[model samples]
Target: MMIAIGYMLSWRKWFDEQSSRLIAKLVTQIALPAYMISTITHDFTAKRLLSTLPDLRFPVLSMLILFALAAVLIRVMQIKEEHRGLFESMFLNSNTVFIGLPVNMALFGNQSLPYVLVYYMANTTIFWTLGVWLIQRDGTHKQAFSLKTTLEKIFSPPLLGFIVGVLLVLFHIQLPQFILTDCSYIGGLTIPLSMFFIGIAIQRAGIQNVSLNRDSLGVLSGRFIFAPLLMTLLVLPMPVPILMKQVFILQSAMPVMTNAPVVAKLYHADEQYAAIMVTETTLLSLAVIPLLMMFVKSGFIT
Candidate 1:
């Protein structure tokens, strides 16, 4: 529905390229950070972390392993260097924040939030570090790697919001209720705004530009199928509760991160391709989610 809304709005000219850029800035820099702070502070606690941390490590480790696998697969497929980063980032990362939270909430209710945060930490950490590097390296102009510049990009507003939220949890500090309320109100816009940006981008790029080629097929399959399978195997043996295991698998199965095109544009990579991947995988997830639930019910995923 969000993508549909974005597409319709763009078709109607309510949001063009310039307006879309502004929306991207607000979502990534302001709204996303605010949302991160609100969710992390509200959901995370040291006691909760103590219990969930061990299980959380499973998801992080699984993600790292998947990253390695993605690198190998990209090499085997001989994907061009320019497109490699986008492929790797798309293949390994999932939409943990935007899609994972709500899906988990619906499937497991409010009690599952801490587990979602666990996946969020892993996803955010990887996304900014490795994900940003991929975008920059594959960007329009390639340059020698610099640790300092990379660090600057990685420590973005969203990550900072996460860090501050973690600090609050670590120190057991509680801000006044009114402040949390304000953050909540501001952060709530991230998803809708993000979808709107995608909508505008789809219009600008034209849906016909999105092709179902070899790379696209590889990406869609990797995100919706193989990634989850690999994570489920890694998660099943963990000592955590069953629900935690399920959350990790479900989060892994989510569509490609919605911010892929936004980050691609920010770093000057193939934003058109990135936008296509995001749009296609997200639309396909509506079907994939239900199929995954069936697997879980049949005890195939566990």
Candidate 2:
């Protein structure tokens, strides 16, 4: 309900394209890195670091399952070979950092923060290395996996923030009170900015070109339903902590990342199909996420 209202409000005409672009840039380049650095810096510790590493394996395995399911679904649906890259990328990648972090924080509070960070770190490492290669296998972009590109991705602002944050934690450096307060304010901007960016990107994609093709819907159904269901079932029999289980289920249930289209565009893949997949998943996930969360919480399927 709140998500719908937020979407509708964000779509209002007053929030023009220029404003949207600026907000996206601000969130992407400035606010997001700041939030990540602050959070990581504050919580950095040997125990937290060690604990966070082990928690990452579940999400990684869950993502692998999603990747297999997406590949199979693409083949079964007979989506064109040329467009399968778009489907694979869109279906496999969730917005773990930008979208998932804020949602998990809201639902579960600070205790779940480390899980979100670790999941995002795992996501970035996999997507940039394996995911990029998978989507760009046709050699559409010669620049894929070059040393320069790999270095750029590794040294990106978010990853750099994580590194610096950990260093700060190791040294036991204390952030001043005003700085900490500011960090909190900046971190809070992530959610609204991410959702607004979604609305803006969809608006830019032009609804006229958006397709509800059978293949696209198959990907969406797989992402919103099958992936989460499978992850819940997998976690059910395991001796994992309940919080980890909830985090996995919630992260799995998130819509395809809004960044999928951007990444596809960068790699010179089928950007139109990527845009369609992103818009479809984002719009539909609102309906699916709440129901899935409720089901997971009630132990109905798990």
Query: Which candidate has the highest TM-score of all?
Result: 2
Candidate 1: clashing residue pairs, number: 1
Which residues of candidate 2, in runs, are more than 4 Å off?
A: 1-18, 40-46, 138-141, 207-210, 299-302
lDDT of 1 by residue, 96-180 (tens): 8656766776687656766777787778778878887777778886666677865666576766776777778889889899999
Candidate 2 lDDT tens digits, 152-190: 764667666666666677777877878877876886687
Shift in Å, residue 275, candidate 1: 3.0
Best by lDDT: 1
User: What lDDT is reached at residue 118 by model 2?
Assistant: 71
Candidate 2, lDDT over the whole model: 0.71
Clashing pairs in 2: none
